[model samples]
Target: MAGDSSFDQDKNKLAEYETSSSGSYKSSRGCFNSKTGELMGRNFFSWIKLLSFFFIFCGVMSTLFGLCMGIFFQTLDYYIPKLKIEDSMIGSNPGLGYRPAGGLGFKTINGDYKGLSIYSSLIWFRHGGDGNFDRLRENLDKFLEEYEPGFFANQGASLTKCDFESKPKLTDESCEFNKEWLSDQGADIKCISAEHYGYYYGKPCILIKLNRIYDWFPDPYDINEVRNHSTMPLSLKNDIEKIYEEKCDDDPNKYCPYLNMVWLHCDGEDDPDKENLGLVSYTPFRGFPGYFFPYRNQRGYLSPVVMVQLKNPTPAVLMNLECTAWARNIRHNRLKREGLVHFELLMD
Candidate 1:
């Protein structure tokens, strides 16, 4: 046959090359299933772009944790340390006043009103009148001409002259004004004059002091555990056992006893009435006393004047005074109370 017709034309070209490779492998698996559905739609937009970058990284870490707790409670009062009491550290409970005399607004002396009015130095003088004592003596004479070398040496006073009649000559043994050990304890040195006992007794003689604190101490075993605790005050524990039997010979650390105790209470007296004339009488003569010698930063260390003499005050009437300083760990009723010093006197 012609070689059996060339083997049936090579078996019809091997069945037309296997049906053209089975339609080219089903069009290359439909172009690899459209590139595997475009790589599963780019892995579902990369999981919604990684969940929108994890909610923008938790909204920038919760806005930086609420701005660092609002800047740490807004500087927590210049870093926590106001009227500390409770485990004794003693050093920042100072501030007590009364040096205005008649300078902070000089309200009147010869004409009688003697200062304090602008609604009584803005309620700090407490209260008096005459329609605000000419604006409380022109804002207390512009605040005593801006604290004039007063406010306890403008608040630092490590003793800058309270000399009281010359007494400083000790070659050595560290003697910076001992006035002969405070005149060997009879104590009456005297030399803190801002001269304003209402210019010598026409009434308002307020010169109370104490407002310098640099190296404060007061913790001789917390003042004998606050004078043998029991909530003290049996007349202040017999005045701290008569200041440890006449100045610490009975040894409560040999002396540092009267840690600050001044108490005047005109309208709140337990027994005031010092010769009532519309009542107002005081007498803490010459500086607070008991025993407090350890100033340390002693720049000639001298801060012991507390004078208070307001007798016969009743010209226009408006007393209500209160000065308290008693200390156990120096707290004075905390904060803006700084251990008390309210005022209000109207001796016309």
Candidate 2:
């Protein structure tokens, strides 16, 4: 009986050992599964990071390529001159009076006469009855009383209604309107008169003149660093020296800034030479809001003319309006048609 009891106890011991081994197997299996999940998560994150990096690289390359293409196209268009009709000559200054230096004038030898039609041309005009001061005062008074003040205030724009009431003093000395603040708006100093016109006898005439000395040949470079290197590309820093050597530099006078000036004049019978004409300035002849003038000429005619000059004289045409053969011929031909007074363009 004692031997049987001992065998049963050994069997019980073997069963306990088996149970402990099963628990350890489960714990090991769980640890292995957890490790596998962590590895998978790490792989997912790494793949996402790699994909984002690839997209970023592609975007950067695309931006660079786009910029390069834009620059190349711009350079091509700029270097190559487009064929444009010589409408500039036809649309230049009010026809009459004197031609300013480095100026262009438009003369209408034959055309239907209408003040509204003349206004349609690119010319600047301030009526002859009052000068800039009086006009400004009149306009300011009307503007203040009109809807402009309320409209500006509602839009959060700040402006003094009274500042321009009498004629604002010149804030900048370089501005012509400022220089003539106290005196007649036409006097003092301002931009060179590119064109002016008045009537002599009964013949309506137009004249173009330069208001300032060498106003046409203005500097192109806005910055000191890039001023001398206008022809060279800004991107190709290393190759700039070579580029400049290959391409000719910009000429201030030769650059035609898509500007044209013309003048128109009409006077009553009496003596044509005794007419006093007003000057007009027309800018950006094409599209909307064309032409503006603030002063009158010595002739007794209303002068509506266009004034054109380049902000940057790079493409070279603004220097001397006479430099252009077609332009010069047009002026000469138009002026000669007038019976009493004829214009001969002589370079000074």
Q: Largest lDDT belongs to which candidate?
A: 1
Report the lDDT tens digits of candidate 2 across residue range 127-165: 233321222223223322322223323322222222111
C-alpha lDDT score of every prediction, in listed order: 0.43, 0.28
TM-score for each candidate, following the candidate numbering: 0.23, 0.19
Minimum summed lDDT over a 10-residue window in model 2 is located at 316-325
Supply the TM-score for candidate 2: 0.19
- How far residue 346's Cα lies from its native spot in candidate 1, in Å, is 18
Tell me the spans in candidate 1 whose CA falls farther than 4 Å from its real position.
1-62, 65-67, 70-96, 99-201, 212-282, 289-348
